[model samples]
Target chain A: MLRVKSPQDLGAGLLFIFIGCVGLYFGKDLTYGSARAMGPGFFPIWLSWIINFMGAVCLVRSVTLEGDPIATIPIRPILWVSVGVLLFGYLIEHVRLELALLTLAVVATQSRRQTDLTQKIVAGFAILFGIAIIATRVQTFAFLKPFGDAVFGVSQWICLALFAIYALLTWGERDARQTVILSVCMSIAAVTIFVVLLGQAMPTYTADYIAPVFSKIGSIFSSIRGR
Target chain B: MDFNVFSNLMTGFVAAGTFQNIGFAMLGCMVGTLIGVLPGIGPIPTLAMLLPITFGLDPLSSLIMMAGIYYGAQYGGSTTSILVNMPGESSSVVTCIDGHQMARRGRAGSALAIAALGSFFAGCVGTIFIAGFGPPLASFAQKFNSPDYFSLMVLGLVTAVILAQGSVLKAVTVIIIGLLFGLVGTDVNSGATRYTFGISSLWDGIDFLPMVIGMFGLVEIIRNLEQESIERNPISTKLRDLWPNRQELKEASPSVLRGTALGSLLGILPGGGAVLAAFAAYTVEKKVVRNPSFAFGKGAIQGVAGPEAANNAAAQTSFIPLLTLGLPSNPIMAIMMGAMMIQGIQPGSAVMTSNPDLFWGLVASMWIGNLMLVIINLPLIGMWVKLLQVPYRLLYPAIIMFCCIGVYSSNSEPSQLLIMVFFAAFGYILMRFGCEPAPMVLGFILGPLMEENLRRSMVLSRGDPMIFMQRPISATLLALTACVVLLIVLPSFRKTREVAFQE
Candidate 1:
């Protein structure tokens, strides 16, 4: 049995050979014209051959020379994070951007569980909201208008600020709950930036599902003013 | 000659000096410094992540902002190297040798200030170098035939392999793999698609964003998460300590001048960029500086000043080839080329003639961006150090969000995210096998262009293989490429390369 001395090189050699073979096999059907009149397949076929030759060289060196071993790959983070990313892609079109973000945060944090870490994120966000509120004096000004519509609606700021302040004071929680809740808050902020401020045309549950509740609240405010 | 250069620079100033453009430049520098100062991230991923936001701006402003990010990274990278002994950007790895030492001795302020000041001086020189050299080089490139272009790309790819760290065989194979990937979209001549694997998103060729973000951005996140927790303890410094004494400044000035000269020249080479320039400057300083404030690697101020200046200068000048010959000198510039193409502008000598404002405005903005970096890095640096305290758990999620949004917002294709995942996994495997991904990126950017030119040249020669030798320019570039390949195979050069990287 020929034992592989340099596992890393051996792995790389195998990978290159695999990639090269895939290129050749897939590119076999395309017309490879003469050198003077090259086809789309000519370059790829030639490249695949070069790669195969180099892989052969690497394979030879793997057994003949000493080299480092491949480091142990940690799978837990890669799995959760990749799943989170894929889920975001699948869910965003079907759900609100905010909910998709929530799903992402939960799945993404799976590898790093039991987070008893202290987070002043809500507090920091409240401070930022306070500054934005003071900047325009409640008269609607278009912020980041280069991107799209004016997102500096005064009513929206007041609501977000109040919510952030409330969250900051009330969420003296610990562990997984804190992680999920904080990420939810952060997700709300991200949705506001991407969907509202940036005016990206992504489908959102906010417009269809949540607008009715806001309108009802507006009606109540108007009725109170009339009285 | 000098007068024409001055007038061109003045036109650039007038074009880019608008309030809106300058504001965008400042914003770019700030954001760039913030991201670049983060550990395990470099300018390539930083540029890729920020690339989408620029799609909305006017061409000149977008290019200005990208330029700011490019060099702002150099500034931010040095700060990370000094305070944390971690190289935030690969170019700053040399700075960490003596810079962290200076920081440990509580002279972090001095080292930081020297890096900022030295980089500022070099930035000014590099901008002027571009103004003086750009037109001449572009005019010269006008004479290049298709065969010559093919040979030049061959030379560029060879040198990129030479410069990429680790096994030459691996880098070569990886570059070939990149070339294969690059040829995946439609075949322009035959009107047939190449290797779409039946995916509609790939008909126009693989989108640069998903590939870059996946390879550099997502892979970076995965790599970081592999460790249990990253330990970061940045050295704190007060505002008052942000100055070097006259003696230290005097010792550093000569080294700065030497490094600037070396960097401005090296950066114009086909494959040299900020990383190589920094490494070379450190080696040169050790040989040239007679009396250091301290010995080399012992918190020598000269050590910090020389490499810092060299890297900044190189970063500024590396844009020359991309802007002039339409050839990106390094992976960062390749990303820049991708951005320019996204803006519907092919980077080449034609850009200078057709869109002089865009070209010159970018040159002028390089200087303004440098000034912005000096200001952002100095007194406001305490904010950056505080940012270092943000735990990795909270930070990476936001990075992922940004990467996802960046990749998706550009094309609005869900398939792009899947592509990102694919490249991320691919990049992770490459990393584990000790093959650097940087060369592959360069090859990917050049592959299509190389094939197109090769076909054109072959047609011109009617399949005669000796056509390359017949053309003078092609002959010369091919000769240079052969020499580079020889250098890569030489035993003595290989030993020196290993020693250089080990440092």
Candidate 2:
């Protein structure tokens, strides 16, 4: 009897076979016309079969051939990062972009093992303050006020504040100084490129605030041209 | 073979040589080099992120810029492979072997110089090949019917299966899964939904940008996080030592020529591209350099030069299949195809005839981009090397955030972010099983085309199953596909295939 050599292959084969079967099930109702004119199901049915054959081959190989065994998966990082992404998706719609970003940054960084706890606690509250200030500034801008209004309601602020405290209690252990700096630089560059230079629409402070600054710059350029 | 090519090229140069086009090309090269210098970020994700930005520019300028990024990344990837022993992209994996060894032996400057020079030479020749061959090939492909196209796609998929590393069975499985993913949208023929699972967002199919970001960018972050903190002491070499000596130059010249020739030829094949070219060239160099002055692994300039040249040559010539046949041989080319479609320019034989300026201008810009890469990279080597010192913890979050923004910017849809998250987990699971995702991406891009052609050919044959056999070109392509499959399945060739990839 051939012994199973690689659990990785076995899992992968099973997954592929499962997906192929699922495809077959779903595509069952679609038309499978004759060779003269293929219906919607013709290509998919053949593809599913091919997938099943390949998966079966993989399954057979898993028992017959020697291969690399599955490594120990890091569940912690996967879970935290996934939750972080989901949280961003949830919050971006409800709480708007800036708060979503803050939440994402705090949650995602939790995946990393932190050595210093005290510094992290300090950074956590400081980051919250910075976020609040930015949120207020965004609300102050004319064009961005609506977006900011939807995000900074009383209940949302309370929820974010509570989450901030929870983050401080459970997750705020890693040094985020460098992360903060990089995020700031990235946001600035993104705004400049996508907004200023390209004239593309993006969620930022506002075009009202941006227009006067650009107009002044444009005037300087026009004056140079005149000269 | 004709002055028509010269006249067309002159038109291209006149269009592409303007200051604005040159500036965009330079910008692309600079950004591409930065992306390549950073580990864990490859060309696919970078291109996907840049796709949105292309909307604002004219098609020709955007294409010129994106093309610059493609080859420029190849050049920068080699630098990282040589300096840090970390390949910034898959195509640079072969470079880490002897290139890093050379760096360790205090020959970093010579290795870097030869890599740059060999790549530049190969790029020039590759561009010339495009200028000479692209038009005729397009004309030839324009004559192909549906059966021929279907057979060619089949050949392309088979080649992808063969060229992919690891188990052949797994590669095929991944490709099949990719095809199924492609089937998730509405069926054009019967107007029936295949596998939307009642999700409205999935009705139009999974967005390519989100999938690519999740698969390559987010999955890489997760994988990097799984590792112990990345702490490596990069080799410190002086800028003055960047020049290769006369003896080294003499040794690398023949290898560069050989690699250029090999890569240029291989790159035209359906599944062959820079990664395969680099791997094949290195193997050839190992065999051809009968008496090596230095050990192959320790510090051989030939090893660096040959693969470097081959990869750059492959990067350039890989455009031929996409430009002429409207077929992408690899994932990078597939992403390029996506960029073209986004610009409302359909890629294929018609591209040359309908948009000759765009075609020739992109070709001409490749040479300028190559020139800019050498000029930009050599002086900026120190900056890139310094960039390598940034902590992975800081870098990962930035990458993720950038990906999030890039995806959101593409369609301004929150659901796309969720789609990205889904694929991120899915990609991670697949990676754990040792399945390469590149083949899957290629399959996803080619799936609809394959189906369209298959159905069209069948309809033309009036239910005759023997249509593929009746068409000479289709029959030949099918025969070639069979040979490839046989070569993979046969025990002796399978071992050689494994050895080639493992090397």
Q: Model 1: residues >4 Å from true position, as ranges?
A: A113-178, A192-198, A205-227, B1-3
Over A1-227, each residue of candidate 2 has an lDDT whose tens digit, in order, gives: 77889888898888888888988899899898877778899989999988888788889888987889888889867876766666566455555555556656666776787545633653454455335435645445456555445545553474467445645554443546656556556656666776678876656554556668989999999999999
Off by over 4 Å in 2: A1-3, A93-99, A115-174, A206-227, B1-3
Please write out the lDDT profile of model 2 over residues B393-421, one tens digit for every residue. Answer: 87776667667767776777767887988
TM per candidate comes to 0.89, 0.90
Model 1 chain A: ten consecutive residues of lowest lDDT:
A146-155
Q: Highest lDDT, which number?
A: 1
Model 1, first chain, TM-score of: 0.65
Name the Cα RMSD for model 1: 9.1
Error of 2 at B499 (Å): 1.4
Error of 1 at B395 (Å): 0.5
lDDT per residue as tens, model 1, A1-227:
77789988999999999999999999999999989798878889999998988888889989988999999998877877787687667556544466556656655666564323312432343344334433433335445342222223342343344445434543564544466566777777776766676577666677666878899999999999999
